[model samples]
Target chain A: MTAKLAERPAGADLVRSGIRAQAANSSFAFVVRAAAVSVFVILVLIVVTMTREAWPAFWHSGLGFVTGTDWSPSADLYGALPFVYGTMVSSLMALVLALPVSIGIALFINEYAPRRLRAPGVYLVDLLAAIPSVVYGLWGVLVLGPFLLPYVQKVADTIGTWPVFSAVFGGPVGLKSMFLAALILTIMIVPIITSITREVFDTVPADQKAAAVALGATRWEMVRGAVFPHSRNGMVAAVLLGLGRAMGETIAVALVIGSTAQITTRIFAPADSMAAVIANTFGESSGVNRAALIGLGVVLFAMTIVVNMAGQFVARRSGRKGAGT
Target chain B: MTVPAALHVPPTEAPPTALATEGLGVYYGDWLAVDDITLQVPRHHITAFIGPSGCGKSTLLRCFNRMNDLIAGARVVGRVTYGDVDLYDDRIDPVQVRRRIGMVFQRPNPFPKSVYDNVAYGLRVHAMTEDLDDRVEDALRRAALWDDVKGALKKSALALSGGQQQRLCIARTIAVEPDIVLMDEPCSALDPIATGRIEDLMQELRRDYTILIVTHNMQQAARASDYAAFLTTEVDGDGDRRRGKLVEFAATNELFTHPQDPRTENYITGRFG
Candidate 1:
């Protein structure tokens, strides 16, 4: 037994195995680090490639590309202001129209709905999101647009007489118009906003809600006092996410926005969005026009990043505040 | 310390009853959580409910202001009355009942709002907005949080310490001038010093509000409460599940020094829960 123990490897063998274990650990770390770094690498690559593709348009239009409104392709005037305005107005309007309805739906599902109905209600809302954007666009153009055109026209004629309303509701209501595009966008984003808002509302601590209720707050008052204040940042984040979705929606807005390049205050008038313009004109464009479309894509990408970053900031701040409490 | 046998005689005059439950039983769906319990909460006194875990002490406390109604399947049998009014009556609005009878929870759940706003929330909800500043200050003072937070009224209540937040909750509850304040393990989440501070505040609050507190700590019940009720879990007939039943109810000193039931004695002596 003593001879066998002397022949067996000592510290040298243990050191060799330890070195092997360290190599294995280092290789595992390297794999995970590569995976984590790849996300940043891919994001940077996309930005660089898109910017390079858009360089010619930037050189051709200079600063006037963003500031100028005209977009006559034959004349080489590729001003993107109209598309930007249409995108902003349509997306913001959709958000304005959708936010209240989404909040109401969320509160109804989470707070007021019967226990048995809540799951079905949530599933139905989620199912709305499952419908394709193209289908929504097709429905918007074929069905809702035509159905609402006459009523919209009538409203424009009557309420359009008011000074402030004239700018918004004015003139000839087209079958495919900004209003139709915005309405479609509203429907598309509602489910996203409602689901997120519902999740945020669910994060409100039960004890805080009880505190409010125990203090004689009516159901509505409890919502206003406890639920609303606690969920403010989360709700903002949800709305911003919905805004990002609305702004980037391509095929749907392209189908219903009539591919017009003009800027108008009238919701009934045909207009074009950044995403819609790219989708519509990309097929036949070349040289600077194509680059200008890609430039628009870059701009939309930047806008989405900004909105999403703001959302992340708010969410993180709320998370920290929640943890502190 | 031994007391004379003659001095142990029960007082003939009982304090006026502020709230009472008659043959009250609480059920969550098919499960009986708390069996039939009948007890009176005397006016302007602190009553503590002591029991082991899963004894439905919290459930019984929630029954006072109808907070149990907020739970999906929670049901209460029999009557809970405040003064002459039945709290569960169809004509009685639970919201109104809550205004008259408020509650503090186990964890200090201050709204993520300004300290002033937290206190003012109740006052604003009840439309008692007149002298809002004074009323808020008065409540904060009553809850023993005024000096600590007076200068920071605009700060978020969440930024306050745990003890301070619980005091803010107490201030918020009493700002509406509720007749009874129900607390469900209000200090169970606090450190010993924080717990002591709350106990001191409770003694001060007992002059105006009839406070009902549920505590797992028998020592807390002995030290802080004027009257005490002991609860224990008992197996239901032919069932494996246990439901909470009241074992003893009496003056705090009497209940601690001389328990009427063997279960209460065993529990107080730390023999078995």
Candidate 2:
């Protein structure tokens, strides 16, 4: 067998096969490289084309396009501040509302749940993410909005009595309101955040967890000592992804956000976000109006990019400080 | 010749028992990992459990601090006692049990925290924060890691070398001033020089703390421990399942030199695992 193996390939034959293998390897490398570069190419194309389409509105309104409040297309007025305000308020509120609940659910599943219940709990939370955003909009309009109206009004009446608190809470409660839209956005983003946090929690080394327990830590203490510091960056990323999801949500916000181009401190008041405004007016919009809608899209894109970059910076900095290299 | 001269000289008197287990059988689901283990661990002495892989030596070591309680579906059907307290009593908190009986893992499992934090973790958790700096320093000093790490207390524990990390883990475990320290193959992941350092440290630590260690290295068990238990796997009836059984427990020198059981003799002679 040794003699046969040694004679299987002569030097000349080995050289030919090596040449063929090298050719195949380079071709495979070329294919994968092309596939990888295509994503960047597509991203650049989208940015260039979108910027070109929105140029007219940028030229027309200049700085006022972002900082000014009015957004009346018929009067040839288009200030994006109202939509920007609505988007920021709704998305940030959603993030604040969803974060704790998502972390709680993740911890419950990963650390506290019984072995039999853990799998089902994860599946159920993931199932929430699988639901269509339109369904969430429908639920917000038909069920959640009406259900929350009384509580929201009670807050407006009670908390609104304080001069400082009255600014954000004092307003007539409506079926289609910023608060209702934000509540729906909260529900929409929770599953994504929870799933990501769960994955991060899983990445914590088992031995590290064992070390904590061996040191006489209670269950919660172990999580705080070992799991939290280890998964800090990942949890930050999860929250940021949820924020991005809440910000770009169109149909859900459009349906429940009251579609009004106005900025108000009262969350119970009707308002419009950037994506909602674009979706609600895009059908009949033409000329400068269409350019203005696309301009809103450009602004939304920039905001998300900035938010993601900020999240990355926070994640990296905290990871270094907390994780200790 | 590497065996210390003191190790060959048996103690003049019997030491008091610090911990004891009776009819101990550990199970994961239905599979019994270790069965009928009854032994008394002497106070302030290093007792080593020597066995091959799958011999449940590590499982038995975990039972000391109730670290097995963390594993899902893992059950202990026996009595483990520290002093007069039944460790498995319903009212006894596993967390508090762990505070009194600490553990070091096979791999050096230091928290992803600064060296200062890693040593202070157990103290902080148990609300023993008074003179925290002194306690951390003392623990590091006891683990023989103070000189190497004192300059880098704020540095991440992970930045240390493998031996330093293991010593740091030792410092973390002893920081709470646990009465007993359980080591599960603490030197298995280390190199020879690091292993020798740990073995020397173990000898120093045995002066104050009761220690139970599970080790695959026979020479380490012989050189470092005062008492030794030799365990081996036995095939269960009507199945291919192998369950760990203790064949002999005796003074370390006696067990290595004149093993009572044929199985122990076989294992010590390198005849079979």
Candidate 3:
């Protein structure tokens, strides 16, 4: 036995080198950590660049940069209140208009569609997302404006009679107005909210659904009890994402918003958003004017971030509540 | 549907049969999962379906409550009767059938909700909201889970241990006061100690509800059940296809000691499945 063992060739060790193996594992971990940290670094870099470029406007105007409404580049007067009002009203209008319609479409696709029609229905809804914003802008200018002008005029004429309605809906109602811009934005954001909410509803566990039906819940009741409760946080997140998209939209709003620096309560009146103003004026402006445009970009970025953070906070708290004690 | 009228009020107390299947066969598309299963489940008694895996015992149990209807391609042939009402009749709403006949699944599927909410779910769904807290407490008491979870009623049901969750599911089912309860392998996911607790709970529940349990554990069938239905799979000529069929159903003692069918005898003797 000893002679045979000696004649046999020595086998390689089965165990790997501990240091080498650990080094390989930690090398992959370090790559992941680097990728994770880069997001924060990139955000900080953008903020620094914006703040540095915007310093001249901040020093010249101080708080007037936000509260002032004048915008004459020749005189170096720059106020962002009109643009801020425009962004807030248009985005809020889009959200209010799109949320119910999106939810209805999502529920119809997931629950009420025939088995054979479900896939194609979902595909059609998702196809809405593929339509370029430029195309929507072109449609808003060429087709939507002509189509909705009479209705806008009629509403402005009729509601303009009442004291309260006149206060809110007064002024010239035109083809290119805040209402048209918001309507276009609503069209663009609906598919986004719809698809995300539909996917969230689909993720509701089959067992919980069964539990609800087993308790004698009607079809609608099952949706209320099991499907809605399970996906409430996800639906909120989807709406916030849609709001973000609407707030940052530039080309579409600029095309139809009749870019003007006047804050008016009348949604039918022409107004300017931060993005629309920047996109329209960034080419011709120079010196403090260019710095002021960058400052508006900073404000828009901050607003979007604050809204997104609030959305995430709400989603997280509701998630914890759903998880129970 | 109006309140109280919408409820399934038994015309008479202690009906001889809670659920009876006549020539019942369940099929998933073309594949017959369970065939020609005709059985009468005695009211307020524990009837256990015992067999090896893939024997369609759970399939047959689902048929009683029309839970099989939830499966996309699944279809049931023949009639399942509850009292004078034919459960499979076209006019009968499955939602009402399910409310009258509740079910407990193999796994503990407590909703991501508080323990109190879990028990109150059926009550609220059925519009039985008048004495909700009292009803929830009574259900927890009946399921033998009240003592352990009383202090944590507001706690998430998911925070409970496996056995406690199963008992919570039972409480949820019984809170609606269904006339019959179907349990599909209720104790299979639990440890021996938890299994023992559930078996004891079953004994207490039998006094108020008709219990039909599908169990793979023959010992459990022998120990806890008043009646035993033995089932086994029979392979077709190609040997690639198998279907479940009932072999013998008798009193638990008789079925265990002197099984009529040779296959059942072999199974009981641990000779073959």
Candidate 4:
């Protein structure tokens, strides 16, 4: 067939070669497109299932289901605000704690590490990101949580004396609290941010850095003046992507977050993130409760999409501005 | 049989001969890149390093500033001194050494910050504070970039053209007021027009600052250098490596007219690289 194609008639040869090239390209494209469509189907299935289950709740209780504060299902009030608050709080806390650490790790790997060690260090950090979120939750619950709560409580009480730390602890100690969840979340996001920030830093032109160093700029000065500026937009996007992961985290957040739907005021208190609430209640819920849980998923999905879009938009604008400069 | 071209300098501004090197050698991970380079770039003159590709010209240029130290496993043997101070001394910080000897790269590499910030970077790093805005402006003027960039002080450095970026780098380097400026093929990546601008800029800069440039463009070396060093490499008998030594050192016109070494004669005449 190959020989025939090679010696094929002129018009037929063009068609054969074109077809062969198209076939090769299309095979790759077909796989990629199939994977994309598979993801689309999965997302659609998830949304449809969630809405099917959550619709009954909206019909039965309306917007009040989201606004209601009473979450004791046994006595029968299931407001989701408290859980939503808990999820938002813990995720934000994780972001706040993880962002700077991630940037530090990334910079350390990119510019600060001794020449021989940089690549290996980055790989080790990325390995941490690959660890399952559940393992993090388990470790947080068994090892880290007990080690942490006292310090957290003490700091809370100390700073709690000040207005900023005023809220009393509301979440569970390990398996049911905002502090544990956030800590686990922080541990998880660190790897993601580190890997991405390092990769972005690598994208900075070596000549650009050389230019700064040539000017009598110190190593720190080169990073502060050149590398950091070039990678800032990318770093921001990386952090936001990590934040989205933190926000949507289910197994880890659920494992540690105390499952409750009540909004409360303490950093160390027990609480529920969106996924945690859904995971905890979905199995037992029928009709309205199931629908409510699915509603929770929809809200989470929308939030994830919003976070991604905003991050991408900021990244694009920053890249343009950097290019313009 | 005959001496290689001795690098020449304008007799008026030649640095004191006492502080220069003898037999400078460089190694990269056990591979000798630059060999048997002996030349003096006296103070206050433009000395250009000219050679074929992979002739260790860049390595030789970087050795003066110890910029090669930044590369891992890059080892240097031989003496580089400033007055009585040995540059490779344990007491000497590469940072401090670099402050005295500045560099400009092949491609224009400006920090991504505003043009003002890019100029200010070196000053702030060295803790040299005396009317920073004035210093920034002075450096820019010295590099001939101030006129174009003055209005856009706050604009990002990345916004500049390739030529402008290279000039910005030169301005940033001089902000520290270094004693020597090293350039490694500074115009290799530029268009002829940009290359011409850099040559003119080099001539103007040589008035107050000493410069060492490595260039493959023999014409550029001929045009801009007050002093020129020619370097090359060879595989010795039994697989030992050796560098091509200086062919002759004389004023640009004299060397081109009467190259003493056969290699130099061939190179200048464009018979071989």
- Give the best candidate by DockQ: 2
> What C-alpha lDDT values do all the predictions have?
0.91, 0.90, 0.87, 0.78
Candidate 3: tens digits of C-alpha lDDT, residues B1-273: 111111122233344878888888888998988888888888988888998899999999988888888888999998888999788899999999989999998998888788999889789888899999999999999999999999999999989999999999999999999989999999989999999999999989988999999999888887888887999998856667788899998777777776789998888778775
Ranking by TM-score: 2, 1, 4, 3
Residue-level lDDT tens digits of model 3 in A225-307: 77887888888888888898899999999999989888888888888899999999999988899999999999999999987
Q: Between which residue pairs do clashes occur in model 3?
A: none
- TM-score for the first chain in candidate 3 comes to 0.88
Worst 10 residues of 1 chain A by lDDT: A316-325
Global CA lDDT computed for model 3: 0.87
Docking class of 1: medium
My TM-score estimates for the predictions, one after another, are 0.93, 0.94, 0.88, 0.89
What ranges in model 1 sit over 4 Å off?
A1-31, A322-325, B1-12
Consecutive 10-residue window with the lowest summed lDDT within model 4 chain A: A167-176
> By TM-score, who's the top model here?
2
Q: Which of candidates 2 and 3 is the stronger one according to lDDT?
A: 2
TM-score of 3: 0.88
Worst 10 residues of 3 chain A by lDDT: A316-325
DockQ of predicted model 2: 0.74
Residue-level error in angstroms, candidate 4, position A203: 0.8
Tens-digit lDDT track of model 2 for B28-107: 99999999999988899999999888999999998888988988889998899898888999999999999999999999
Which tens-of-lDDT digit does each residue in A13-85 have in candidate 4?
Answer: 3444567788999899999999989998998898787777678766766787778776665665557778777
